[model samples]
Target: MSLPLPAPVSTYFEISNGSDIAQVTRCFTDDALVVDEGQAYRGHAAIQSWQRDAQKKFAYSVEPVGLSRNGDRLTVTASVVGSFPGSPVQLYHVFDLAGDRIRSLEIG
Candidate 1:
């Protein structure tokens, strides 16, 4: 069964399946921050750059296997298979939403 995700979170995963960088950025707030691999991407410009860099570096796909909430954060546990060092890895995506958009996300 698929977990029920919020609008922006749902959109994030949906767009992530493809290479639509603009759609991915649209799921976040104007001042959103995204952290992945110890690098922080602030705002759409930085986020776009991050996405582009990742796309250029690896060919990968992510499948969200679980979801849970903690306080104001929603955490999605996903299985990611990519061209990186670890072909398959379980990642934690913690999202903080503001209204219909995501305010922040930390992926590990």
Candidate 2:
């Protein structure tokens, strides 16, 4: 089942699940911030690098199972399956959107 997320959020997941580096890069703002695996990536270039590195390390799939909103921030809980220590695990992705682009995202 899919949740009705914001356009940018939905686009983010779509491109991310497909592991399209270029498209994924387009979903974020120029100064977008992403925190993942205890590392902080700032700016589009850094975020792109992070996404690429993660994709190269693990072939993964994310299914958004839950969503909650607070002002401009949206929290998404997803079930992720991939080539990692934990084959499948649930993760919380907190996203802050700026218009149709993602301003920041923290995943754990």
Candidate 3:
């Protein structure tokens, strides 16, 4: 039997593994909003800046462990590893999808 795959997990992997700003930008809407650690970044420009800054500060990888969806919203539990003291961080991502792109993403 074929196992069912999780959409959010697949999308998360695609976006996380993508190093190109243009390719990653394609995963989000034109006016997408991303919130992380109480900071909110709106639009592609801000998103790209945030990604660049993050890459500079932390060398990490995101591994999705669980996923759930409710209508246009998707929630994912991921394991994050970086250069910080507590190198590994467990994060929850809440994604709001509009069609094939993500309209908003909140992380905690």
Highest-TM-score candidate? 2
Provide the RMSD of all predictions against the true structure, rounded to 1 decimal. Answer: 1.4, 1.2, 3.1
How do the predictions measure up, each by TM-score?
0.92, 0.93, 0.85
Compared to the true structure, candidate 1 yields what TM-score?
0.92
lDDT of 1 by residue, 1-108 (tens): 488898898888776666488886668998899999999999988887888888788988888999999866999998889889978999999999888899999999
- Scored against the true structure, residue 102 in model 3 reaches a CA lDDT of 83
> lDDT tens string, model 3, 1-108?
112324433554555654565565667788999998799999988887877787778778887777787998888888888776687888888889888788888999
Q: lDDT of candidate 1 vs native? A: 0.86
- Best by lDDT, which number? 2
User: How do these models rank on lDDT, best leading?
Assistant: 2, 1, 3
Worst 10 residues of 1 by lDDT: 12-21
Compared with the true structure, what per-residue lDDT tens digits does model 2 show for residues 48-68? 788778788899999999999
Q: What ranges in model 1 sit over 4 Å off?
A: none
Supply the TM-score for candidate 2: 0.93
